[model samples]
Target: MTAIYSIFGRISETIEKLAAIHRLLPWILAFALLLPLPQILSALFNDYYIYLANKICIFILLSVGLNIVKGFCGQVTVGHVGLYAIGAVSSALISLHFGWSFWLAFPIGILAAGLAGIVVGLPSVRLEGAYLALATLGLGESVRIMIAVTPLFGSSTGLLSIPAPTIGSFTFDSYTNYYYLVLAAAMIGIYLSFSILRSATGRAFMAVREDTVAAAVHGVNVTKYKLLAFVISALYAGAAGGLFAHMPPGYIHHNNFTIIEMVTLLLMIVLGGIGHIWGGIIGAIIVTIIYDQTLEFYFYQPLLFGLTMVLIVIFMPRGIGGMIDRYLATKKFIASQEEKSNAAS
Candidate 1:
């Protein structure tokens, strides 16, 4: 019995170590690819691989954006899909109607999403907990209905024939080009978000999240920061929306903004760990890959998703990112203790 327990403990330690490596691996590879490594690899691979790479990059962007609001800002929003829809439609309308290029449409669409976020978020200053969630719940349905009614938004049929993004003279018609485009945008967003969080504004936002009243007493300007958080998050969703609409398929529908879509985004944020940027990214990737692959294999993907979600929430409330952070902190503490003891000797 003792031997069996020891073996199990060893296996668990080994698995945890591997998981840590896996989490850090993506960032390392991303950095490496930005160096001479990508050139070496591209020398061997073809364009098809780039296509799938583009998909993953786009998902990473979407997750990272959603994380800005839900994870970092501590916003319990369930209407992210609606924000995404607003962004997608906004850009689609401009590009479709006026032939506005990516340079113009992308920023415009993001601003539109921000405006929508403010429109919805500005009214929710007093509502917290379930009330905020409930109010945002109405937003998704309301926008969904509006899209259903207006022929300009494609009525119930939704928008079709959305144009691909073109930057200057270059048309983003190929997956490889679009992949680089999306990757660049995602990298910009990730850098800006991390940079913002390290700034006074980000600190104020975090303070507001922890305790609004306490933040106010500290002169953090809670209302201003909170609105900033919402707008930043909406900007992310809007950019992602434009990417989704401009991708290979080059079409979108209101069904893409369904309630489940919003729920899934929130689930990714919660399951990965709230108030953590990387958490949202991992959660999004995990959920997207699992649900996408599972649906391909069978139709009962929801059952598996629900089960996974429940198990994660029940057993690891802080989520995968939280667990990783704890582990890292512990490791560093132990190393510091070891150094201190060695110095004393």
Candidate 2:
């Protein structure tokens, strides 16, 4: 703890200085989020594509959520799909069985999922890296089995006929309306993530991620903050699952937890950048687009994912995000050198 505190104590002034300048950037991000894609949503049948687009937005939100725990906090949680399932089941059961409205249930579902994350976080907090990963994988599997074995969850039959979110009388029935709702949700997730990374907690997460022992010495409550990250990640996941449950053109069969799916999410974060949100964004888009476009050509889907992951890892230790950071570092270094030369001359 002293080490982290000492390092931060030394650099605290600089960090605060940077934060002052960077805080307003969130508004710019808000604007950027609102800007519509000019070329893509142009077709009359683009509604179908918009449907695809909404799915991407959902995945992006999920990826961002996963990034908080797995990427930034240096924790490995393979139980995210379990979190998803929890949220969906919470909301769906309330709506389908109890006759509660979707509106009342959505937020409740998110809270329930948050509680689940905290529960999952408790045991995992004592663990780190591979051990923790395996624990979460086990948890996910357990959750899957519980859902499949229980009649309430419809076992293998699975739950169907979800209600949709609405504002008063206007049903979010159209693809465009649904797109906006999911997009707004996705944007909110991105914004929160950005804010988090810039804040003091984020720096602590990075410190722990880089070296837990060292980070602890610097006064980071490693356990607490790691738990916080897990909760934040799961919060996003729950919101996504809730939205997925309520939104139309809905999922017929909920995805069961698999080692492969967990590995795929890890691949997404690793390929994007461990702590970088943009990495998840990029990874999710690439993975989802390929998966959607190539399902008919089933032979190459897994092969392409494998090839993409292997090639990126070989060439890039930091993945795509790492390379971008390196480039920025190099550019700054060269610029500083040029300035020094200019001053000397």
Candidate 3:
């Protein structure tokens, strides 16, 4: 462990030096590298990999939102997928029935999801823990059921022929084009999430999560922060859903936003590390890849996912992100100790 820490410490120092040369250097490099992923996947593998990449980006958004509410705010919400459903269906309907452009309908979809977040969050003001979980679960399921039964929501036929987004002459109709759209949105969502997590409001959220009573005593406005967390998370879900809906061959089914999907999102955050900043992104990428690889075992996927979550919670409560954080901390401590010893001598 000491040897490993020493190696990591040196690597960390090098990365920090590189970062210090230019704050956006790392981000610029990451963007440049990721920007070619679709083309590379298409050339090396197939366009199917590009599709999978798009799915990964969408789930990244969903998982990040879930982490905000469940991981950071410590709110148990199982109804997030409902907001995703609402966003998709609403955006589709607006484009389909009302003849609105996809661009116009997208923001409305986000707003609608935010409004539903308030409804889901209202119960939180009076409930906590399992009760809140149950409330959210019920609400989420109810949204799916409503879409399944209502004709306006397309019912069993599902919403179909929804148009792709366009800007002037160019339409995001191809897989590669749509991949860029989702990628840009996912990147923006991640950057905004980091900004939020580092802000005063983020600190207030952690305070509330650590102890609601203590947060209230400190004038943190616990209820307000709780609702804000839900709304912010809903916005992410809505954006993801809207993007999914607007993809080429745009269609949305009731089953797409079911509790199973919610469970998948939960597995993602758990695998990554609940409260760790990059946990959602890491978990989404890994889970989506594993899921695609194990498509033959579709029947047992839920059970496997649930068992994995259980194992992670029991054996690695902090998840992968937490493990990385601990490793880094240890490396820093070891480096500081070495420096102190040399100074003393």
Best by lDDT: 3
User: For candidate 1, lDDT tens digit of each residue in 1-345?
Assistant: 445444534544664575487844444456446544234446777555566566556666667776766666666666767778888888888888888886688789889989988866774577777887788788867887777788897777777777777766888787766776777777777767777787887887788778888888998876677677778888888998888877866787888888877767767766777766667667766777676557675667667767777888899888877776676667669889999999999
**Whole-structure CA lDDT of model 2:** 0.76
RMSD of each: 6.1, 7.0, 2.3
Instruction: Write model 3 residue lDDT over 181-296, tens digit each, in one string.
Output: 88888888887887789899899989988999999999999989999999999999999999989887898999899888999888999999998768788899999998998899
lDDT of all predictions, in order shown? 0.73, 0.76, 0.89
**Which sections of candidate 2 miss by over 4 Å?**
1-45
User: TM-score winner among the candidates?
Assistant: 3
Worst 10 residues of 2 by lDDT: 4-13
By TM-score, how accurate is candidate 1?
Answer: 0.85
Q: Of 1 and 2, which scores higher on lDDT? A: 2
> TM-score for every candidate vs. truth?
0.85, 0.86, 0.94
List candidate 3 stretches off by more than 4 Å: 1-25
